[model samples]
Target: MEKIKNLQHSSILFGILFLFLFVIGSGYYLLRKNMLQNHKAQREIIVLDIQTKVESLLSALLHSYTLKKEEIQKKHKEVLSFLQKCGCDPLRLNLTPLYQKLNANYTPPRYNIYITDENLTIKNTTFKNDLGFSLRFAKATFDKHAKEHIIGVSTPLLEASTQKFFSYSDSYIPKTDKILQLSYTYEASSQRFQKIQHFLHKMGIVRATSYIILNDGFINKIDFATQTKEKLAQVIEKNQEDAKKILKTLQTKSRSIRQNKDLQTIYFVVDSPILKDAKVLYSITFDESDFYLKLATLKIVFLVITLFGVVGIIFLWYLRKKEIKLSYQEQFLRSAMHEIQTPLSVITLNHEMNTLKTGENEFTKEITNALQILELSYNELSFALLATKQEHKVEKLSLVEIVQKRVSYFKAVAKSMQKKIIVESEDPSCIMISSIELIRIIDNTLSNALKYSDPKSTIKVEIKQSNLCISNKGKKILDTKRIFERYFREDSAKGGFGLGLFIVNEIAKKYDIKIKVNSTDKKTTFCYHFKEAECI
Candidate 1:
C-alpha cells in the first residue's frame, strides 16, 4: 500500500518533468531553425547587392570608353579639314598653331598627329619618339575600309605604354600620298578613373572574392585583401582554363552557384547594351565560416540553458519527495489516535462504575486523576484529526455557559494538583460556533492551566461581552511567539505533547476567532476575542 502511494506521487512529478523538457526542446528547435533561415536570406541579399553594383560599374566604364573614342574621331575631322585649307602643303602649315587650337578643347590633352608614307612607315609626327616607327597593322585597316577617313582600335606598340589599347583615326592628305593619323590613349592613372577603381576595390563584402570578365577578355579582380599588389584590369588569355570554365558556366545559366567545402562560388551573366553581342561574366566566391560559427555558438548557449533547467526540475522532484513522506507520517499518526479512542472510553467508564459501587480510596483517586489527564491528551489529538478533515456541526451557544461547564469538568483534575479554576462572567454572551470545537478549546486551556500553574494557584477564567480570558499564576512562557506552533514545547518536561494551544489556534483561525497571549514573570494569560458575538 505504501509503495503504491509513493509511486502515485512520483508519477505526478514525472509528468511535470516530461512536460518541462518537451516545452524547452521544442522551443530550442524552432528558434534554431529560424536563425539558420534568416542567416541564409541575409547572405543572399548581400551577394545580390554586390552583383548589382558591379553591373552598374561596368556600364559606366563602357560609357566613358565610347565618349573618348567619339572625341578622337571629331579631332580627326578637324585636323583633316585644317590640312585641306593649307593646300595639302605640309611646309606651308604652322603645326604649333593647329596643335594649340585642338588641345584647347579637351582637359589634359592626350592627342598626337602622325604622317605615314605609302610603305606604312611614319614620316612626320607630333610625338618625337615615333618619327620613323612602322605602322604594322594600319595598311590592312586602310585597304579594308577604302574610305577617306578610317577609325579603329589598335594594340599599343610601345611595351611601356600605360594603356592596353588606344583609339586612332587615319585620314588621306590630298596629293601628298601620306596618311594623317590621330591617336588617343585613355590613361588608367586619370583621377576620375582611379577613384572608380578604388570604389570597386572597397565594395565591402567580407570573406568574398569577386571579379568581372569584360567583353575584351580583361578580368577586373575586386578582392580587396590582395588588391594592392595586383592590377585592377588585366587581359586574360583565351586558353586560360579557369577563365574558360567561368565563361562556360555563365553560358549555361544566367546565374549558377557551385559550392566547395565552406565556400560557394556564384557565376552571374551581366546584360547591357554596351557589351552588345559579348557577355560579361561576374563571379563571386562566398565564405560561410562565420555563419557556421554563429550557429555553433547558439547551440552551445542552448545546451547550457537546458542543463540548468534540468537541474532545477530535479531539485523540485527532491522537494516533492520529502513532502510526500511527511504527509504519510501525519496520516499514520491520525489513524493511531482513532484506534486509541474506543478502549480509552471503556476504561474510564468501568473505573467510574467501580468507584460508585465501592467507596473511594487514595489509589482509585490517583487512577481517576491519571485517566482524566489521559483523556485530556486524547481529546486534543482527536480534535486535531477531525477538525482538519471534516466540517463540524455549528450552533449559537452561550460563551459564559460553555466556560462554566468546562471549568466544572476540570475542577476535580485541578484539586488533585492542589489548584482550582474560577469562572467570572458579567453577562450572557453568545457566539455561533461548533459545539465539539468550542468544548475542546475550553477544555484544553483549563487542562494546561491545571498542569503548569503553581500547585496552590487559582486559575481565573473570565468571560466579558465578546471575550474569554484564562489567567494563571505560573512560570512565564519564555517563547510566547511560538506557543501556538504545532509540536513546539518550551519545556518538554511539562508532560504534554504541546498540541493543546496549537489546536486552539487552528480552530480560532477557522471561525475568525482572534487569540492573544500575555506572559510575565508572575502570570500568563490566554485571551480569545469572539468578534462575531451577541450579548443579551
Candidate 2:
C-alpha cells in the first residue's frame, strides 16, 4: 500500500509539469503567430498609404502641366485662324500681339514659339531677333514633318542651327491644313526648380532628396531641393542608368515598385503617356528606416511585455524556493549615472575653456560650437535621467530674455552655415521661469532650427506678448505628433541622439509653459505660450 501511494504522487507531479510546459509553449506560439500577422498587415497598410500619397501628388503636378500645355495649344490655334482670316501670308503677318501674349502669360521650361511658312522658313518668332531666320535641323525636320501630317508633336531631339533641344506641338487648320508648330526647348535650368525645391522643403521632405523629369538618355529637366556633390553625382549616375531601365519597363509594365539593392530605401515609379507623344515618369523614394523605426518601437514594446510575463511566471513558480535580488537594479542605476556624469564633466570643461582669454580664430570658433553641441547632448541625457527619477522642479522667470540669449548663442552657428537669425519681440520684459529650464527649452528649439534649416536661409525668432515663436525655412518637421518623443528623428541620415525635443517638453511642463507647433511645405514654427504668467 505504501509503494502504490508513492507511485501515485510521482505520477500526479509528472502530469502537472507536462501540462504547464504545454500551456506555456502553446501560448508563446499563438502570441508569435499573432504578432507576425500584425506586422504583415502593417506593412501592407504602409505600402498602400505611400502609393496613395504618390498618386495624389503626381496628379496635382500633371494637372498643372496639362493646363499650361492646353493654354499654349489654344493660343496657337487662335493665331493660325486669325492669320488665315486676314489673308496675310505667314511671312507678312504681324505677330506682335501673339508674341506679347506669349511673353506676358506663358513661360514654359524651354524653347520659344515660332510661326513658319509652308516652305519651312521661319516667318515670325517670339524671340526678339530670331524672326525671319530659316529653320534648321530638328526645327526644319519638325516643320517638314508637321507640313505633311498637319497635326502632331515632335520627338525629343536637339536642333543643329539653333543649338537647342526642342519639343514641338503643332495644330492643323481644318480645310487649308496649314500647320502651326509651338516649339518648347529643354533648358533644364530654370527658377521653377528652385521654387519646387522650396515647396518640398516646406513639406518636411529631406533636403538631400531630389526629383528628375527624364525621357530616354536626355534629361529634360531636373530638380534638387537639397543636394551635396556626392549625392548629386550619385543621383545623376543612378538616374542615368535607372531612367533607361524605367523607360524600358514602362514599355512592358503598367506600374511597378522595387527596393534598391541596398534595401535601405524604396522607389515607386508611375508612367503616364500624355497627348503629345510624351511619357511622364513620376518616381518617389521613401526611407525604409522611417518605417522600420516604427516597427522597431512596436517590437521593443512586445519584448518588454514578454520579459515581464516570463518574470511573473518564474516568480510564481519559485515563490517558496527563491529569494529576490535587488542588486541588478542598483547596478543599472549606477552605470546610467556614470554614463551621464562623463558628458556633463566634458561640457563643464568646454564651457570653462570657451570663457577663457583665448584668441578668436577658426579653431576657437569650431571648439566653441562643438562644446555647445556637447552641452546640449549632456543636458538631454540629464533630463532623461531626471524624468526616470521622478524629480522635476518648476520656477517662474522671463521667457523673452531666455529666447534672446539662445538666439544670440545660435547666431554664431547659424552664421557659419551662412544663415541669419532674425528676432522680433512684442515685450522686452521678464518672464517667470527657472533659467536652466528655460535654457533647455530654447536650446532644443534653436538647435533643431540650426541643424535642419536651409544652409543659407533665415531663422525667424518672434516673441509676441504671450507667445514665443521660432520659425525656420527647411524640411518641414515630419511626424510632429511624435517628434517630442525620445529617439525620434525626421531623417535618420541626420545623426542625432533624438532626445532634444523630448527634454524640451519636460522642461516646458516643469515651467508651466504651453508649447505648440505648426508646419507647412515652406516653413515650420514652434510656439511657446506664457499666458499664465504676465510679462513683467
Candidate 3:
C-alpha cells in the first residue's frame, strides 16, 4: 500500500512538472518564432523603403539631366550678367522679345527672367501679370555683397502672384539698387511626397550606379564607373542572365524576389513613372551574418536559462518529496495519539481510583510515574498539532498559578528521573494571554529543565511578576542561542523531539516576551521576560 501511494505521489508530481515544462517550452518556441517573423518583416520594410527612395532619386536625377537644368541655369546667369552690363535706364527696358525668343518651344516656358527696382517691384518682366509684383514678400534676399542668391528646387518656393512651383536666383546690380532675378519652374508634388527628392539629393545617391529593366527588352543602366548611361545592347551583353530573369519575372508579374544566402538580396518591381509601359526593378542587398549571429547567441542564452530552470525544478521536486514523507509520518502519529487519548484518560482515572480504594504499592507508584511521562509527551505532541491548526481563545491567566500547576504536573516525571523541581514565585501576577498558549509555555519549559538536568539533581524554576526562569545542572549547552531552535538536540540519547524550548520561545514572542539564555559549566538557565503583565 505504501509503495503504491509513493508511486502515485511521484506520478502526480512528475505530471505537474512535465506540464510546467511543456508550457514554458511552448511559450519559448512561440516567442522565438514571433521574433524571427518580426525581424524578417522589418528587413523587408527596410528594403522596400530603400527601393522607393532610390526610385525617387533616380527619377529626379534623370529629369534634371535630360532637361539640362545646369546648362539652362548657366545661360540664365549669362543673360543676367549681360543685362547687368547694359545699365540702360530707370524702368525703361521691356525684355519681352528676349523672353519670347527663349520660350518659343513650350506654351508655359520653363524659365522666366524678371528685374526688380529699388523698391523691389518688378520693373521689367516677361509675364504681364507680374509687371509690378514686389519681390520683398518672396522670402528671397538679394545680398549686394554676394554675387548671387539662389534657392534650390529641394525647398522650392511658390510665386506669390502666380502660385507656380519655382526656384529663383537673384544678383544685385552694384551701385544701382536693382536686382537681376531668374526663376525656373519644376514638377509639382503633394504634401505627402514632397520631401523624397530633397532627402535623396541630400544623401548624394544620384551619382551611384542604378539599373531599371522594362518589358520591351529595354534596359536603362546608369554606370557610375564610366559616368555614362549604358545602352540596351551594352547592358544585355554585360548582364544578360540577370536582365533576362528580370524581364521574365516582370512579364509573369512576379516582381518580388528575395535571396537569403550569404548575401541577402531583394528585388522589387514597380510601375515606372518616367518610362512608358515599363516596370522598374529595384534591388537591395544586406549582409545577414551579423543578424544570424545575434539570433544564435540569443538561442544559446535562452537554452542556458532553461537548463538552470530544469535543475531548479528538480531540486524543488526533491524537497517536495521529503516534505510529503514527513507529512505522512505526522498524519499517522496524530491518528494514533487521537485513538490513545480515550484509553489513556480511562486508565489514568481507574489507576487513581484504585489507589484511593486500596493501599499504595511500588507497582502502582511506578505505573503512575510512567503514566505521567506518557502524558507529558502526549501533551507536547497534542499542543504542537493544536497550535498549528486551531485558533486559541484569550483570557487573563495567572502566571503564578500556571507555573505551579505545570511544575506540580511534571513532579512525578522528575521524581521518576531522579530529579527534583523547585519553583520560586517572587511576584504573583496575572497576564492577558491564551490559556492553552500559557500552559504550553510553562509545560515545555518545565519539561525541558527536567529532561536535561543531571540525575538526582535539583531543577529550579523561578517565577516573578513579569518573568519566568528555569535553571538546571547538566552538561553545559555549547551554544545557548541555538538551543531554542527547533529540532536542535544537544544529546540524542535524551529522547526528545527537541521542540520543547522552541515552543517556549514561540509563546514568549507572541506576548512581546524577551527570552534570555545563560549557560556555563555549572548550570544552564532559560529565562522569559514578559513585557506585558498585570500586577495583582
* Candidate 3 positional error at 287, Å: 9.1
Candidate 3 is scored at a TM of 0.57
lDDT of 3 at 482: 81
Clashes of each: 0, 14, 0
Give per-residue lDDT, candidate 1, residue 189: 23
- Model 1: residues with Cα > 4 Å off, grouped in runs: 1-18, 52-322, 451-456, 473-482, 493-498
Model 1 lDDT tens row, 1-536: 23324454555776777787788789889988998789669757866776565455456555656677667778887887878886755633457776777778667666778878777788777777887888766566665544634555342221233422245677566666677787765554233334434544454322233444556664544432223222222211211136457667667667777665454556666654356555555555444556677778878887887887788678767866766655575576566676777888898899999999997999799889889888888878777766767888888898888888778778888888888888889978899998898998898888887777887999999998879999999899998879888777897898676778888888898889988899998999999998556645
Worst 10 residues of 2 by lDDT: 1-10
Best by lDDT: 1
> Which candidate, 2 or 3, would have the higher TM-score against the true structure?
3
Of candidates 3 and 2, the better by lDDT: 3
User: What is the alpha-carbon lDDT for the whole of candidate 1?
Assistant: 0.69
lDDT of 3 at 390: 80
How many pairs of residues collide in model 1? 0
322-407, model 3: which lDDT tens digit per residue? 76766675676678788889999999999999999996898898899888877877988787666767878888778888888888
